[model samples]
Target chain A: MTAFLIENKYTVGIMLGVIFGLASRILMLRTDYRQYPTYPHGRIIHISLGVIAAALGAVAVPALFNKDYTAITFLTLAAQQFRDVRKMERDTLTKIDELELVQRGTTYIEGIAMVFEGRNYLVIMTAFFSSLFAISFTWYYGLAAGIVSMIIVLALRSGKSISHIASAESVPVKQDGPDLLVGDIYIMNVGLKVNQELIAERGLGVIIKPYNPNGKATLSNLGQRQAILYDLSTILGVYRDDGEPALIPMAKLDMRDGRLAIFLLPQEKNASKAREIVLRVPILESAVRMPTEAKVNQQEGS
Target chain B: MGEIKAVVTMHKQQVGGGAPIFVADNVKQMEETAFLLEKLLDAAVHDLKNGTFILVKHK
Candidate 1:
């Protein structure tokens, strides 16, 4: 048994590597409340790529053992290939967003694309580690290594949500004549009395207060604001149709205090649920600005 | 993000335009005309508060 294991160590190591790599990819590919990657077709495309990534990672160790120096070039080629995947995701998502009622803004789409590309790299890393451990020690060590890498990858997958940087609460959606206000922050003008009444009846308002200058700067980004609205509407269901501009959701800044006020007309008018959703909105990576980190502001921030 | 596509006003004297305009006889007539324009145009009505309602199409 030991002789057989020693003779086919590379084969067993590669199998373990591919298995772990594919598992991580499948685990990361979730079509949850976000409903991203769009079911069967999208799932198939990503999974096929995962297989290729896994194979590349697994074979690298054997190639190095054979002293085949040219094999390192494949990894570089894979990086280029993965980058194209990011571009493909971005282009497709941007095109789809144009037709959405509550569009997933560019920041959100870019984040998703980055996530996809990052996950592929993670799979490669996991496969490499698992294969390395398998060939260097035993197949059992490879399993342990795979599990450890999977945990780390999953842990790193999620970034900060709104609650991490700010506090969110339900506020009243009020109107002073023609002006729509989320608390004291004016959202927009509602000209028609009928539409105003509808908004009054159906509108859900939220106020988000940032904890620091960094949070404030992030929230102030238009892309981030649009992402917040997009997520809120997708989960809570927007009470709007195409060309019905009066029923549109809006987020406005209270420039004085760096507070944000959001006014939404959701199909479901549950305040607590809306508040929960607001807190859970993923902070966009591009929108995150650490203004306090600047040398000029560091002294004051500290 | 929005462009005023049409204007419905009680005071014909209040507005002039690059966009189309509809003049109404009274407040009730102005409201009715604006409401019709809002539905027909599938736009938002914004009260200028000078007896004018502008129908805006938000893209």
Candidate 2:
């Protein structure tokens, strides 16, 4: 039994590598509160792709040992395929965003699509390294390498959230006649008496105060503000039904101080939960603006 | 559908070429014009600060 194990070491290595690679992909693929990569169909699609990626990674080392140079071409093909996957995700999310009360802007959608594409590449790298270690040394070595790679993957699982860049505070929702204000920042005008009454009764307000110039600039972006609104509405569940645009969640910028005021009539009506959601909202990569790093700003500072 | 009781007017001060739309003299007139537009053309009102409100058709 020991002799047989030693004889087919490469085969054992390949199998272990493939298993590790698949495990890493599975660990990373998650459909959280957002319900993205939707249920059975979405999970199946990603799993299938992960299998292909794992297979490619596991097979590459053996193919190289056999001197089959053509195997390298498959990696290139896989790269192209993953790029297409990113595009598919972007298109689907964009279409879905249109139907949303507070749309996830193009920037946020693109960031999410990019994340999906990048994750596949990470899977490929993990599998490739695990297989390489196994083929060069032993199956045990490959397992160790796989574990280390998985840790790295886990470490980089997600990006920074809004709380990292700004502080969110629960603010007073005031109705001055027909105008709605979130901590002195004008949100909207409720021309209808009924709408005014509804807002006065149920509306909750939050003010996001940016930590620095960069944070301030990011909050100023319409897309970033919309992303905040979309996330808040998605988690808390919007108060209004379809066609009731009057009760839609809104995030408005305070032009004078760069603070963002968000107003929403949530079904949950939990102020602490809403504030937590805003704080934990992932900062969209595309919406991040660095005014402090700009050349003009540097020159002015000098 | 509800009665158009209040209105908000928007003034576009930019480089453009189009027929002059209704211009309101005061807040009351603006509210009346906005209400009329809301009823005549089924649109949702969005406030874009500085006394401007955009009336867009809801999808």
Candidate 3:
């Protein structure tokens, strides 16, 4: 078996590379509470793309070894294909969001799309490095490299959640006359007496206090706030249905201190669990702002 | 900001614009009209605290 492997080294190397690449892709493709990528169909589409990405990455190794330099340009072509994948994800998610009771805001959708694009590149890297090791060194070395790279890539992919930046505390849903408030932060004006009563009785609220200016900037992003509302509604189940805009969930910022107050009318009404969910909400990449890292802020601590 | 779909007010003289305006005879009638408009138009009712409620379709 070892003698035959040496004879057909390129084939064995490519096959192993493809396997590792596909494995990395599969590991990255997760169906969490978001239920995004749908079910069987979404999985199929991504897996097929993964296979293609793996093949492209694996082939480039042998191509480079054979002095077929022109083949490297195919990686660029593969990049174009992945860009289309991002666009496809964005378009699909945006259309689906319109029908959602709590829509995933554009920033969240963009982050998801970016993840799809980035994962493909990670798969390529995994395949390329694995194939290079297999062709240059040994199959066992290639396997080791593949495993190490997969761990590293996944670590990069697993970004921080809201809890890393801010702390979420359960707060009372209050109404001061017509103004609906979550703690001291005024959310909105509840016009109808019936709606106000329903909110006061069944509503849940949370106060998200950012640890620093960076978290504050991120929390204040409209898209980030919408993402929080979307996740809360999805997990806890929103009380309102079609044509009930008055009972919709909202995250209002306390301009005085950049504190976020979320008002939700959940079907389950579990305040502690809801606060946990708020803390665990994925921070959108686009929404992440590092104002403290700026030159002016660093210079004088202003 | 959202488009004001309609207005339900006890005093018609207070509001005037391109959007449709609904005038009610009293406080009870104004609340009832605002609630109905909210459901029908799929909009949020915001109280002006002066017996005027604006139904806004928040996009």
Candidate 4:
């Protein structure tokens, strides 16, 4: 048995690479608070794709060793397949967003889809690297490379949040007659006196102050603002049900100063937690705007 | 979606049951009201293909 293993070390290397690649994919796959990639079925689909990715990655090294250069083309095909996975996720999420109480905007949906697609490439890289190291050096080197790749995968899992760019503070939710205001930012008019009273009693307000021009520009995007509201509603629990127009959480920009004022009636009235959620809201890739970096803005600044 | 037909009406008195009540005299005013509703109430204006815009707010 030991002699057989020694003679066919490349085969053993490929097997180990496939295992590590699958492990990396499994490690990255999680159904979190959002309940995305939902239980059994959703998870099964992704896992099956991960297995295919792992197999493809593992076989490439052996194929290359035997001078089968055409095996490299399979990687391109795998990439196209992964892009389709991204499209599937986007289409699914867009359809689901239509039914959400607080909809994740297009920017957020796109960001999620992009991440899903990118992670598959990471899986392929992890498998390819492990296979390469094992075939070129030793089996132990492959194990080391796999571990390192897994760490890289873990590090790249999540993107930066709003807190990285701005600061969020709890503010007073003030009512004057029918006008609902969050820190002088007019939220809405609660025509019903009873609803006004409920808002006065239960509403939580937050003001997000951007630290720099970049943050300010990002906050200006309607999609980013909507993303903030969605994240807040998702985490803290929206106070209102479907068709209750008055109770919908809103994020409005203080157009003059670029400050964002958010008004929400939360099931959980913890102001600090709400603020934390606001700060932790991921900045949507599509909604990110860097006016500060633009030549026109720079010229005006100087 | 076709070119949006302009039909603007303004309501001075408050409507009942927490439903959004918009009052505007012209297209500009209607747009302003719609903007306020969007920012303040998080309502979306959907064109119904019947030459009318329905402002719907999702919780």
Tens digits of per-residue lDDT for model 1, A156-195: 8888999999999899999899999998999999998888
Model 2 per-residue lDDT tens digits across residues A162-231: 9999999988799987678999899877664566788888999999999999999888888888888888
The residue pairs found clashing in candidate 3 are none
Ranked by DockQ, the better of candidates 2 and 4 is 2
Candidate 4 RMSD computed on C-alpha atoms after optimal superposition onto the true structure: 7.4
lDDT per residue (tens digit) for residues A1-302 in model 3: 98877777788889988999999999999888899777989999999999999999999999999999998999999999999999999999999999998889899999999999999999999998898898888887888889998998889878889999999999999888889888899889889999999998899999999999999999999999999999999999999898999898999999989999999999999999999999999999999999989899899975
Off by over 4 Å in 3: B12-21
Docking class of 3: high
**What's the best-to-worst order under DockQ?**
3, 1, 2, 4
* Highest-DockQ candidate: 3
lDDT (C-alpha, whole model) for all candidates: 0.91, 0.81, 0.92, 0.80
Compute DockQ for each candidate against the true complex. Answer: 0.78, 0.17, 0.86, 0.07
- Model 4, A1-302: lDDT tens digits are 75665677789778878888899999999987778898989999988899889888888998899899998899999999999999999999999999998888888889889988888888888898898898887787888999999999999887788998899999999987667899989876654444677899999999999988899999888888888888888788888876466677888888888899999988899999999898888888887878788999899999
lDDT accuracy of residue A185 in candidate 3: 91
Candidate 2 chain A, run of 10 with poorest lDDT: A188-197
The residue ranges of model 2 lying beyond 4 angstroms of the native Cα positions read A294-302, B1-42, B45-59
- Residue B27 lDDT in candidate 1: 86
Top model number, lDDT = 3
